[model samples]
Target: MSNYIVEMLNIRKEFPGIVANNNVNLQLKKGEIHALLGENGAGKSTLMNVLFGLYQPEKGEIRVKGEVVKISDPNIANRLGIGMVHQHFMLVDTFTVAQNIILGSEPKKKGVFVDLKQAEKEIVELSERYGLRVDPKAKIRDISVGMQQRAEILKTLYRGAEVIILDEPTAVLTPQEIKELIGIMKSLINEGISIILITHKLKEIMEVCDRCTVIRKGEGIGTVNVSETNVDELASLMVGRDIVFTTEKTPAKPKDTILSIKNLEVKDSRQAVMVKGLNLNIQAGEIVGVAGIDGNGQSELIEAITGLRKVESGEILLHNKSITHLSTRKVTEAGVAHIPQDRHKFGLVLEYPIGENMVLQTYYQKPFSNFKVLSFKNIYQYASRLIEDYDVRTPSTRTKARALSGGNQQKAIIAREVDRSPDLLIAAQPTRGLDVGAIENIHKRLIKERDKGRAILLVSFELDEIINVSDRIAVMFDGQIVAEVKPEETNEQELGLLMAGSSKEKAGEL
Candidate 1:
């Protein structure tokens, strides 16, 4: 009596103090692209996890192809032709793409050991069919993020999965890469693969999905055809408000060069230069946005500036003072605040209390310490104030940094770094895992810093965010900056071309 491939009727899920989903219902049509849209903590992710067999619903009945079945574990779900791509990737860094693709279900030779050649052949065939252009022989660590994502998709297809759930698949991709993903999704749909896309981005949902289901406050709102809904309507439905896509930022009145790198060349741990001849200038009261495809020397450039990596040959000046060889602490003292790209690794001590994470950079300052004695009181007070101002939602400051949701974790880091009021603020992927509200707040704060006469160097993979918040933009290719353009004068096409390693004139100068 069902017309869909998968259905969940009256689903209910609960966690200690939270009713994540309440009497929710979702249905996926065969060979169609479906989207689940919601704000943060809206039960979208919870619903997908339940469908993926990560959680068991306390109440509800699930039917697959009109037959009711129980999926107690991921293996059972996989057997039922279901595969999930998590928001954060699960690929091992040291493993090769082919090795990772065949990790769980490796082909056998003579019913013993592994037959990598057979596996590679099938993997390549699957990638070709799905248009997932990935080099199976390449290591996951050395490949581009877009290619890694393709490998993940290929892994799902290689496992003979028919129902695919993609969680924010394009969150870390560039403009060209996003287009490729969309094309792949369409091809998969044409091949009779049913897709369930979970994302908070309205634009992507509108562009790629046929139908969309909106959830709010752990309750199902409604489902609609994508063609019938507008972004404004989707925004209002998601957050129950009329959201503004653009912020009102004043024009930049750039002053003295607060941060400058001249003839910079940075090397990684292996002593090979990754950033070559990177001469850039960020002036006071301006946000110089760096837009590039991932693996275009952005990481090394940020590391060099933040004291995380050594510069082989460069002159870095903070307000005309050389701070290149200074320690991270010394650089912080010299008026440099950095919101690192990897938040958990460099931004916070996940096992430590939230109060401790608030002063991660300045814990050794005078007010936070007395000689060898630490001032827990001052630290706690400062942490509480930041939590209040930054809107970081948590039960208390004593809670572990890991306990906070992704958005709140980002908020904590932004609060800590921006509250320092440094002369130069380096925010690298500051809103990487955040929701719309958090992104809006972070963007406003970045504009606020620029308006307050603080030079901000923002490096992000999100083109929309970069184009919206920045007054000027720089494109990085390989290990150097290839082009610089004003916001009002550039389109995504030009930027995408630049990111793909083409110069302005070569790409038909705009």
Candidate 2:
């Protein structure tokens, strides 16, 4: 009998114009957390998709517990005890947790109607057993992202998944939630379940993975025991070069105020005040970072400034001109560019081609359009240039935005927003799902823009990014700026305390 629980040998998957996976090999041992590491568009997800039966390999053999099997679809994979949790969660917003989990497989009372009560009961027990504390009755939209992810895990567990594939599980989680997830992974392994973790973040692999396999440009590099390899080695193998963890930048040269927010008050869709009496100013040639836990009014502030949300009572000035109530296009026309936090929702139209998405904001202006008629030739030529400049790996500029990897999608958005060279750039969670190399490039671009005498407002959950990229750090808590400190003078510990509503003196004393 084979020692491996699952083995994919010589897997190759091809798209129209590119080979997504080329003779990649992976072996998952019993009850071990095996990590799949690669850069964006490097075929990590494609290989896992093939395992989950979402796609068929052009050439390969898959062995499950020493038995060769053909997994033709997700149902077949599930029957083989393999389940996958995708990066972008698949759940109906209106459905309750229990309903969503037991959608296709439900307990029928008397073989007529679904016995929801019985399903919830089973789900509760399963959640408890796996330490995934989710409310079975809560609507998916009403729950936090972390809770939703836990429910996704519970779905796999309830379906009797002996092997679970988590693709970038921690990408959307908070630090505390990430720690909890790590604990959950350990518990799952203790119960004799195996895991395949696909991620770009090196820290998580070092913390939890037993072993890691590196893939570069759709080709298998090698696999190594996590204990024997450091982050530097893995990163070099994945990207074919030594990755720089830190961003290098010179001192900022402040100029006149570019954007100023005074007594800004904004309300959310539910009519709740999210940004309360917020006051901030950004000068040309500097980047000011807002550091806060998620849901502390960062989104509201960005929306209000970019004209995506209505400002209840406040003044937003761009070059001393009021832009508080302008339309989104007007705001953009006023030399303000926004790289939104939710890329799919606000940044790009998934159905549109990459070239079209690049010119979304400037489609009406020439040379992209002449007399309101779009020039496809000019649009694609412009997109090709940006693609080359930003190093965005895509099949072609004609590819759909949804078809690209998450990191590559983000790069496209950044390319479009930054290439405009606006006076004030608002970057919200700009490097959220990017790899180390991509993050380095993004930081350099932000700094390069700042050096061009543009004011930048950077809002992010990453303390390392906030400290490394920002000229000044603004600690936000409870919908307001609690304190402002120079990046060089503060550390993550102090920032954490401030983000938790601790006073500077209290943090210092502690």
TM per candidate comes to: 0.91, 0.99
lDDT by residue (tens digit), candidate 1, 1-510:
678989988999987677889999999999999998876657777788898899999999989999998888888888889998877778999999999999999999999989998888888888888878778889999988788888888888888898999987877776678888999999999999999998877888889999998888789998989999888888788777777789779889999999889999998777777899998999999999999987778999988888888878978999899989888888888999999887877988999999999998888877999995889999999999999998786668988998666657888999999999999999998887666766787899999989999999999988788899999999999899988989888878788898898878876565
Alpha carbon lDDT of each predicted model: 0.87, 0.94
Which residue window of length 10 is worst by lDDT in model 2? 170-179
RMSD (Å) of each candidate, 1 decimal: 2.7, 0.8
Best by lDDT: 2
Task: Name the 10 consecutive residues with the lowest summed lDDT in model 1.
Answer: 432-441
Where does candidate 1 clash, by residue pair? none
After superposition, candidate 2 runs with Cα above 4 Å error: none
Model 1: how far residue 18 lies from native, Å: 2.5
